[model samples]
Target chain A: MPHREKTRILLVDDVPENLLALEALIRRDDVVVHKAASGDAALELLLAHDFALAILDVQMPGMDGFELAEFMRGTEKTKHIPIVFVTAGGRELNYAFKGYESGAVDFLHKPLDAHTVKSKVNVFVDLYRQSKVLKHQLETLERNRQEQEALLQELTETQEELRKAITIRDEFMSIASHELKTPLTSLKLQIQLRQRYLKKGDASAFTIDKIAKMVESDDRQIQRLIRLIDDMLDISRIRSGRLTVHPATFDLSELVHDVVDRFSEQLAAAGCTVTLTVPGPVVGYWDHFRVEQVVINLLTNAMRYGAGKPVTIVLEAGDGRARLSVRDEGIGIAEEHQARIFQQFERVVSASQIGGLGLGLYIVDQIVRAHGGSIRVESALGKGSTFIVELPVEGNRASDAS
Target chain B: MQANTLLIVEDDPDIRACLEEIMVSEGFEVLTAAHGREALQALQSAQTLPALILLDLTMPVMDGPQFLAELASGRWPEAWQRIPVLVLTAISEPFLAGGVAEVVRKPVDIGVLIDAVARHLPVSLS
Candidate 1:
């Protein structure tokens, strides 16, 4: 154990001579004695330092020992100091009772015995030292308990997060497998149909229109399979931070027009009429193909949710940036789902109603950010939603050039 | 002889067309619906009740379990309740119900599906 500081004792009396004598008799290596010529001076000393014991002379001219003890008892800071009242008065029971009532632990008749005073003072010093040690230990214990509680809470949150990640991964695997199987089944049936036709050994059975229709259906299914695989690949690339963009200058209006034209057939099939509005040739330096993909994803999403409704696409460029907005009149997203829509494998709609891996918006957001752009949604439930994307006109090319 | 009508309830157009063609070639009249809601509507308007129903378990508007509950709840006319239902599903477990005759797993073997249909129909059209 570390060496403790010396215990302090306050020796107060009206006469300086008596204070000196008491200090000389009680002085020891483990104790420090502070002498005061009056009770008021003793209170000043008590205010400045913490003493284990106070030896006071009862018959003093100003602020007598009994009065000082009463004052000390009334004050919060000095009330706990162990007091010993020493006087030359006779050892009457009434006087001793008054001394004890004034907060003195022990009373000594003066012309005091040296050993008796020393022993009584020693007991109080020992108690104060033990209490200080106990308080320090309690503080350390409380701190450690709080730290352990915080650590436990952190561990529980981490475990919950890990469980959620595992669930999403399992769901992704099952959905991907199901999507792949559906196309494979169609392909198998088509092949079986062709084989049966050939087995009949009639070349005339392979008419031009029938062969063309079968080929068209097979191509459509193959495209669906390719789209699913591409989405998976994109997710992996994004997770590994390997998805990169190559910048080239292109007109924003032309790119939007092309993507809209490609989706025209599907939009028409879904009973949706898309109106594209572009002010002029708004040119920008960014990955043309990736930007095209962003527009395509937004348009496809609008068509999926807003089937049989009108969609509007607007492209505007000014103020050192380009903005493209796709508005749809469909069953809009709820407020609670808006924030999570950009996260991987998150979908507000059921997969049975709208078949997708839920990677479309995630990929779109990633590409937009890579081009130094931001995307946001504005909508209310039961009304339609508008997805707005803003990209810097220069498009992070300055860093590449340097 | 009155033709045995088969009802095919499936969401996928390709699968529905394929089954329709196969059943027609087997000499049975076929009617199709995209989901349970559509199937219920068809049943309500039909001139003659189907002898057998080939039901897909998963669909967009309504699913297999919901359809079965509605059918058994006495919502439809009495003549529609006696028709046997054969479930066609990609799911592993069989759907055991009073009206369900059998469960045929997909990708369905054409012969197995046809045989199940023939067994449930009052007259084997083949």
Candidate 2:
């Protein structure tokens, strides 16, 4: 409906006067006429332009009207254009049958009737316009179908991803509930036993040494409960996108030594010894509290899985980056579990009865990445695992999305 | 056979000690293990099989279900099968261990546990 292009007609004749007369008679404001004095000239025009109809003079020097019409029918590009043949022959000569046989839509007699020529040309031009509109509409419909198919594919993929996320969330809730209850169970049983002993007025059970030991055991359970609750809080903070890094200048070696010293009691209880190897003061600008958290998590994991073996901590600074590594010579992660250990609630050692919310490594990874840093692990089954974290010394790198 | 003996298998040291203390106070001989594997070792070397086995489901090396499976595999004496095994677990899901005399969800009620143990013992402590 929006097409504004003029309808074109090509007129070919050896007689220059006849070509001129035909073009003049049919020319209108919305029509364009082209005249060619020979078959070869007409072919050049036909190959260059898309015409609605082609009218050929029957009596020509080399190629007659019938011959030209046959050539047009044989070529792929020009085969669909309607052709009208003009002849000087009378009605008895049966030129109409010959014209139709040569792929002509109609015939015109010389000493041509002006009315017939105008009306016949009009009919063919109108048909050509309708076909052009139909071809455009079909192309638009095919394009729409392809776009819809692409949209459907995109929607299906998004739905599958959402389903997987929901499954992970459900699994996390179950594991969290189980983990939080274990220490509480111990605490509850301990309290109940003591209350029962006191109810019977047993003085021996409340002796100085026995009471001290009970207090120690109570402290251990309380600490475990507090740590589990803290992990859950951190997970919620991360979920709400509130975990951010606030940078400060500090000595990396000093921070590591401080955290390790604090864990001395735990290490001694686990029967594990720490070998700290810091060449010198490795200073950096980073979120001091968050970096301390990373060290604590890594050390805790090393002690838990170290099998009472020696644990090693190393710190080095070079190439504008500080690298920290914690190595444990105990049950190591398998090759298949290395990549998944940092994901939320993904405990590769679930069957081993290791305790915690399984959010330690995930939190560590997040904190490191937010500082524009990286973390990786190298381990094998029974060979021990080493976790390495690298942070920018200047703390000037752009903080990544938390 | 030490029919008055009870074997307490748990992963947590505090909980294991608590159970041992409670059973000892109730006039029963108690043997403790850190995990299923250690419990298995103790059973193999004991002078007499225990009258009852108190098991925790999740443990390092060998868990409760794994221990139950190994116990039912006919690798040990047939009399070991007759010993009532009570599962004490923090898990809320339906337990699937075979040949268990009772399943207690944690935090367990002390009265319920004592009554259940007393009911399963060949000779009542009272």
Candidate 3:
């Protein structure tokens, strides 16, 4: 409630002298008095102000004290105001009963007792002030309850997110253990076999061709271990927001060509070939090393799952963006698995068959995003997949926006 | 004398190669398959039943458990089911498979693996 300096009371009487006398008795610096000669005029005042009390004269020319009190009772805004009826009649006339019937809190005789009137008005004013203070306190409590409810809802959502993160962490640990153990097993067995030959004094096991093959096998396993460890490091860097993109101007076509040229030996080993469809020099400003990493990841995936089929690389640039896509016609991913492939440790095929850490596409996605670029896949089961990436031509725009 | 033959079923090419090399050096004729479906095909077409089998649990197109279930479904001769299978795996869970004689965790000790294979063989390799 707004702070009010004075309490207001209505005084309605036919004679101006009677109203003035009553007002003088109850009026104080903290009290405001409104006087009216008729019931209609008093009602007008009643509708305009919130009064603490209303004292009505019984013998008015129109609308007597009892009738005015009934009117105030019927009105929603004025209904709660305490009514006091002042009449010149004696106790035998029973005006007090009628005044009480019309909802008057008290009755006053025309030979008004000044102390009683002043004291009654003061009591009503104090009651109104106390009720207003109580209402203010109730509003404060309701607002605090609502605020607490909102905070509890936020906490529940955060807890659910934390639970999901922990599950992912646990799953990643298991997969990592399994993948790392595979190469270690191969290495251990190879070395044990060589050591046995050495113990048996078998010079035949160290023949030029046999030693070359052993070195090759060891190198392959070591490379596989190195690749898995690098992927794990990349994931940690991405999660920690430390995957920085240092942008520089370069031709995307040349980069694709270079990546393809480098992957030629791997492609042939997998019995796969590449088809490049670069119209011209599609140039852009992007992180050179990171973009090369993206290319290598995608191309490696293409060859790995391409089922010895031809892989296609396409590049185009226009309207401040460069688009690169790699398409393979091998065993494709199902629609449901396509979206999840870019997430951490997600693979469409079994780990036993493919022999991967399942972080290739995820790392590729993070690298692309760090360069203010986006990656998406269009694939269906057994029809093959096309991975598309789009990057902004502007240099370091991702960092600039942040 | 029963022929000393071993069938190896696995998907990873490198691991498959290593297993083949180890078995061949041990004076055993080995038949290899990339997955369960291929292993089944090889078994159906073979002239003689292998004395023992080495199986990896996880694979594409078909898996070890699925293959074992098929082998026990009366699709092949009763002699085929008699061939003991040694399950070699990296998975850290207890697996259930029909006709699995023993389970060996990978990074397997060669002596332990050989002893297990010998115990399941109809006639031990010389």
Best by TM-score: 2
lDDT per residue for candidate 1 within A294-323, as digits (tens), equals: 998899899877877999999998899999
Candidate 2: interface RMSD equals 1.7
> Poorest 10 consecutive residues of model 3 chain A by lDDT?
A95-104
Chain A TM-score, each candidate: 0.84, 0.81, 0.77
Best by DockQ: 2
Clashing pairs in 1: none
Q: Give the RMSD in angstroms, all C-alphas superposed, for model 1.
A: 3.8
What ordering of candidates by TM-score runs from best to worst? 2, 1, 3
The digit string of per-residue lDDT tens for model 2 on A142-180 reads 889899989999999999999998987776776667677
C-alpha lDDT of residue A145 in model 3: 91
Q: lDDT (CA) for every model shown?
A: 0.81, 0.84, 0.83
Could you report the DockQ of all the candidates, in the order they appear? 0.37, 0.62, 0.47
TM-score of chain B of each: 0.93, 0.92, 0.92
Top candidate (lDDT): 2
DockQ of 2: 0.62
Count of clashing residue pairs in every prediction? 0, 0, 0
Name model 1 segments beyond 4 Å from true.
Answer: A1-7, A28-37, A44-48, A74-79, A90-104, A200-205, A398-402, B14-28, B56-58, B63-65, B88-126
Better of 2 and 3 by TM-score: 2
